[model samples]
Target: MASKLIHAIYKDDDLVLQAVKQIRDARYHIGEVYTPFPVHGIDKAMGLAPTRLAICSFLYGITGLTVAVLMMNFMMIQDWPQDIGGKPSFHFYQNMPTFVPIMFELTVFFAAHLMVITFYMRSKLWPFRKAENPDPRTTDDHFLIEVDASDHNVDKLTDFLYNTGAAEIKLIEN
Candidate 1:
């Protein structure tokens, strides 16, 4: 089914919170909210699920660390096996101090690159990505709420918005 958006352009944080409260009171479904900056208590007002990004980030970091360790160990011990400068050949783990720099570099390299890619993917942000915002001003100045109306009364929705201090309200098909 095609999604619908009940778009409201709010003037300030107060208006945003007021709308959020109205929506909660009426028990309306909200799809997403767009704001130039965070509105304090907005999430609580919307009753949004806490983001899982932190868990995903930690998992990605651990994966990067594992990759780094495996690659470094494979290259240094198995690939070349160089006895350069008379360093231990078979078990460099004896001194192990020498491999610290390589391990650190690989870990940092993998973590930095992988984290960037993972974050972008998780956010669905990529190059040439043009987002659909009903009012460009919302991206700069206004606060916006995009509510998902589920076969409900449009007049009632507008009435709720009016009561909640929404400066402007429009509907968009998403």
Candidate 2:
């Protein structure tokens, strides 16, 4: 079955935000929204759930810290003991101060890299991936609101979108 959708393009981000609020208030099902840059509070306006990426970042940082500690312990104390700067490598705790900088750096490195990779994978934006935006202008200067129109009146939706300050409206079927 073919599903009908209405693409509402707004020139300004503020207008798009207002249109989204109006559309949701009118009980219309919004399929998606595309924007060139981040629109603050858009997720809340769209009634989307909060993200859990911060939790993942924390876990990744902990893992990196653990790995750094173990690696330093094994290399400095267990594998081959070293005496540098008159500091004994007999105990990890005794020489822990010197490894603090390495541990902190590794923790930040792992969290940042893993968070970026996770964001890319979650958004399905891997290298060589085809673009899924319905309008090319959305990547430049337009913000698009995709409304589900399968069971709604097309003319009414068009009127509502037009009234809500849409610069352009396009009907798409899939």
Candidate 3:
């Protein structure tokens, strides 16, 4: 079955933001939004919840920190206990300051790399994947809001979008 969508095109981010708020206020379901750049406050206007990526990053950092401590403990304490600079390698606490830089580096490395991977996986932006933008102009200078028109009167929705400052309106079936 083909789903119908109304693509409302706006020339400016502000115009699209305003249209999104108005459309949501009118109780219309928005399928998606495509824009040349990130629009400020569009997520709030579209009534989206806050993302939990930060929490994931924090957890990843903690995991990295744990891994670093374990690796250092195994290598320096259990594997090869070397007494360098009169510091005992058997006790991890005695030489903890020397491993601080490595621990910090590993924590940041894991958090940043894993966060990026998580973001890509969550967004489904795999390599060689096709784009989902209905209008190519959205990749340039336009902002497009896809309003679900399957359950609504298309004529009324189109009129409402036009009045909400859409420069171009398109009815698409997908």
The best candidate by TM-score is 2
Model 2 ranges off by over 4 Å: none
Query: 1-174 in candidate 3: lDDT tens per residue?
Result: 679998889999888888998999999999899999999899999989999999999999999999999999999999999988898886899889999999999999999999999999999999999987788998999999999999989999999999999999989988
Which pairs clash (backbone N, Cα, C closer than 3 Å) in model 2? none
Best by lDDT: 2
Higher-lDDT candidate among 1 and 3? 3
Residue 11: error of model 2 in Å? 0.7
Per-residue lDDT tens digits of candidate 2, residues 1-174? 899999999999999999999999999999999999999989999999999999999999999999999999999999999899899888999999999999999999999999999999998899998888889998999999999999999999999999999989999998
Flag the better candidate by TM-score, 1 or 2: 2
lDDT of 1 at 140: 89
TM-score of candidate 2 on Cα atoms, chains taken together:
0.97
What value does the lDDT take at residue 170 in candidate 3?
Answer: 87
